[model samples]
Target: MRVLFTTWSSPSHLYPLVPMAWACRAAGHEVRFAGMPSAVPGIVGAGLTATAVGSDEELTGMSASGKLAAWHKQEQWPADWPEHPDRLSPAQVELLAALGRKQCVIAERMVDDLVAVVERWRPDLIVSDVSTFAGAVAGAVAGIPVVAQLWGSPGVLRYENRALGEEPLPEYAALFARFGLDAPVDPAALLDPCPPSMNLGSALPRLPMRFVPYNSAGEVPSWADDPAVRPRVCVTWGVTAAKVLGAAGLEPLRRIVTAVAGLGAEPVVAVTAAQRELLPALPDGTRVVESMPLQLLLPHCDAIVHQGGAGTALTAAAYGVPQLVVPQRPAPMLLADRLAATGAGRTLPHHVVAGDEHADKLVADALDALLTDPAHRDAAVRLAEENAAQPSPAELVPALAALAAR
Candidate 1:
């Protein structure tokens, strides 16, 4: 069988689909990943066949201007938008509509190219990141099955769609009409990697798969082998935050490093090369490593302090490490809340991290709790066990094949 995997241009989005793609390949199926040109490097880096479908210039320009980051700020959104969708004021409804239009615009740019690829390649199945609407369109156009893959979030997009009464925005409806297809072609199945305890209930036909962390591979540092004289804490703000939010994003990193240091724990700052140059001077004893994958770093650490990215939070949970999440956006905030509810982690809102006069003390206090508390560790271990118990990607290959065969 030929399988086409699709996602948007972000590596975080692409990474979640890799394990399943690899599973298909191991089962002797032909696989190709389609995305914007910017995603090619990540697709290739994961050792998958790449099929670049659309231009990256628009996304690149948005990131450079910080417009993309600005859209992600949680403060601009109504606090009750998720729970109280019916009670939304006119302005709040407009805000939600605007966000939907933005997504539709991005989806529109890729649909033509994705549809063309579907016609030429004629894959039996298309596995897509949950946010990649173009994949659903292409699958509908070609009359093939599409499987939606979640990136360890609590199905936020699904929740939002339900809240919106499952109606497509006008922009989305127009995009579908252009191709002579119906709006909102539901996927045949959802491949969820989030553990059952961490997952919010979803009405979709869900297939539980283990999250095998595949943040691009890197060389393990020599220091990683040495025994720690003090408790080692991993501090990271993830790749997207620093690039989109600029200096404002790095400020939390500074506070986290200070907080870890103040508590007499070693701060292992994991960063990209660009982020390394932008960071301010750190206190002595801080170990700064560039381009190191968290999978390699998290196992040895006592705890983690980071931006509440799904990949980071889930990876730490898989390793059974306690977490202190400093979240800037609603998605991450939701992930942090869910993680905290599981008794495995805690959340610190970006407002408090950036605005509190004693932000370092607050962070220190939280990090200190994660380090000293035995309950956090015990809960983390249980979460890890639950994660490990899910069906492996290899086990799910037959189910996917059956869907395509149907």
Candidate 2:
């Protein structure tokens, strides 16, 4: 069977899908990943065929920082910006809508790329990231099945609002209508990478499928296996967060470093080029390294400090590592709170973070509480157990194979 895995341009969005795509190929199925051409290297690195969809330069030029700055200047927020009455005012909503409308111009081009791929490859099934609706529309047009991979918060889905404790936005239905699909898609399967233990709520309408855990890209560092060293702690905001938060947001990460330094465990900070630019000279005993896949690092780490991105949070859960989620964004914050509520981690506000805040007094206190606290550690471990029970890509094959056999 041939599978076409479609996704958006972002690394956070594309990385989790890598293992599954690899698994599909390992099973002898011809698997191809379609997205912005910038994603080609990652797809090829994963050993999957790359089907370029849009321009790499064009996608790279779309700046989250620029969009946020414009929105901030206009006192605007995107309508899709999570429901934070304080952050997203009526004026902000207008700004967000205007931005969203402009963004659709890029999306339309993405759709055009999807049409071209379908015209040529004509695969049997399209496992797509919902943000890239072109693949879904193409699947519908070609009469192939498309399974949506919801990488972000549940708010993107109509019913997910209620589950995620958000008020339903009737307007989103119209957004979906524009894509020529029912407002609330009855997913063939809702492969939620977020662990159910996180309590994100099950707003998705019931379908033939269920939520699954994320497979993060990093591997466990070699030192993790040593019984001698105090457990290692992995400190990282998601790739996008470390980049977007600039110096101010990253200041908290530095504080996290100061707080954890003298404590028992070794601290490892994983950052990308964007973060390195703002990274203040690091304190001694704290190691800074380039990006190592999340799956690779999580096992060695005793816990995590991050920006509360869904993928990273779930990745930590899958490893049974308690998390400290400092969400600069409300949507990711709300999701972080849910995980904290489940006892998988604790949530910290980004505003209070300061140099003195690193007083190690407060940061160590929190890390100690999370690590020693049976409730938090237990919850994360339980979720890890659940993830292990889940079938890997090989397990999902029978179902897709059945679809193809038809």
Candidate 3:
């Protein structure tokens, strides 16, 4: 079987699907990754066969300014949902559906190239990251089955076929016709990595896979292997936030670092090389380094403070490390909500921690609660156990094969 794996250009988004792609390859299926030129390197770096499908427009002279927050809206974030889209009012549904289209707009640029790839490669199956709509359309055009997988919360699930008041989102509906195919708003399957305790009930049937942490390749710092006598707290804001917020990310990172340091815990900040200057002067015992493998860092951590990227939060949860999430986007906010409810961590709104006068105190309080409380660690361990029990990506290969055969 030949399988095509598609993702938009974010490493965070692509990382979640890598394990499953590897599983397919390990099972003797030919797996090829297709995406924008920006995404091809990460795919190739992971040792997968990569086919670049579309060119990212350098058309605009802006350094990093295309669709900065497609699905990162604060209001549209699942602020209040009982895991049911039916619970929302018509107005809310319409509004959210619009945001959902914006979330998927990247696919519009890639569909033509993606469809051409499908025509040439003629894969038996196409598996895509949840946000990669072009692959679904291409699969529909190619008459091959497509399965969508999630890295985190179901931001897209809430808007499936939802009306937009007088102006509804005809995204997939119109999108399919544009390619001369009838698009099924839903996919053949939805794969999720969140533990059952953390997962909101999925409206669509879900295939749960254990999230194996995969950071393409990074050297483990010498300090990571050594144990610390004091409590070690890892602070990270993730790459998306740095790109979206630019120099402004410093304020939030300051609060996170300051709060953790105030507790006398040794703070290890993982940042990008460019992000190093943006960091505020650190407290005496804090160490800031660019690009440390999170999987290596998390196990040695007593607790982690992060902006809620699914990869970051899930990795921490998988390691049974208690987390304190300062959410930059709605998805992280949603993830934070689940973690807090599950007793594995705590969540603070970005505003509370970003330049608010009380930000330092508030963050310190949350960190203290996570640190001294045995319940947080116990719950994290429980979630880790649940995460481990989920079928591994390698184990999910037969199921994918069956889906394709069906």
Candidate 4:
């Protein structure tokens, strides 16, 4: 069988779909990844076939100028977002509607090009990132079965449902009509990577796919290879957070480093060169490297302190490393709540973050609690056991092939 995978232009969006594509290829099936022009290089670099489509000059330009992150940070709800999503304030409803509208704009950019590719390729199965509705539009036009890969946050989908009745999606009804489909969009299945304890209790059809960490590739260093003499903790932030918080975002990450360093455990701060520029000083015994493959680093760590990006959080869970989630954005708070539920971690509210007058002390206190407590470590092990039971992406391929055949 031939499979075509499509995703949004962002690295956060594209990286989630990579392991699954590799799984399909290893199964002796032909696979191709299609994305907007800016995303194709990443797809090709990952050793997958790249089919570039559409243009991301506008989104790319916004990111380069830091306008996109600033926009996202303003609408971000911190703590109350996990409240009953069905009954939200008009302002909250408006925020959800605005998010959907923006996605539709991005979707519009790719759908036409995606449809053109689908027509020419005519693959047996179509797999797409849940947020990338362009792939759904194209697969519908091509009359093939489509599966939505949930990078698996129930909070995200739960948040998405708020905008459902308010809009018909993409605000481009003509395209559905152009493709001869009656509904705006639909998928045959949703492959979710989140554990049940963490997922939103929605009615959408869901299939299980274990969370796998695929942090962008980096060269391994000699220091990383050496076994640590004491408990090692990782302090880091995702790219989205840096962009959203701008220079101030580094404050939260830096605070995490100082807090963890004082706890007598080793703190490894993984940052890119661009990110390192914002740092003022490093705490004693705290090592700050430009960056490293997180999957390689987490296995040796006792704990992780982060801004609660799903990729990093899920990766930490997979390795059974206890974590302190100092969430800076709306979505990370939800992920932090779910991680806290597992007893593997604790989520800090926005009040304890960068804007707080005593942010550093509060973070240090949290880090101390995570290290001194044994329960967090025990719970992390249990969560890891639970994930180990889920079928990996490779295990799910035959089922996908069966679905395609049906």
Give the alpha-carbon lDDT of every model. 0.83, 0.64, 0.78, 0.76
The candidate 1 region of ten consecutive residues with least summed lDDT is 60-69
lDDT by residue (tens digit), candidate 3, 200-299: 7655678988989876678777777787888999999888666656678666887788888889999999887877877778778789877776887788
Off by over 4 Å in 1: 60-70, 76-84, 87-94, 159-164
What pairs collide in candidate 3? 94-164
Say which candidate scores most in lDDT.
1
lDDT of 4 at 362: 80
Q: Rank the candidates by lDDT, best first.
A: 1, 3, 4, 2
The top-ranked prediction according to TM-score is 1
Number of the candidate with higher TM-score, 1 or 4 = 1
User: Number of clashes in model 2?
Assistant: 12
* TM-score of model 1 vs. true structure: 0.94
Cα RMSD for predicted model 1: 2.3
lDDT by residue (113-194, candidate 2, tens digit) is 7877887887887887755555656676567777766664534432222322344234433434565666534345555555
**Candidate 1 clash pair list:** none
Model 2 whole-model lDDT (C-alpha atoms): 0.64
Kindly indicate the candidate among 1 and 3 with the higher lDDT. Answer: 1
Candidate 1 vs candidate 2: which has greater TM-score?
1
Error of 3 at 262 (Å): 1.4
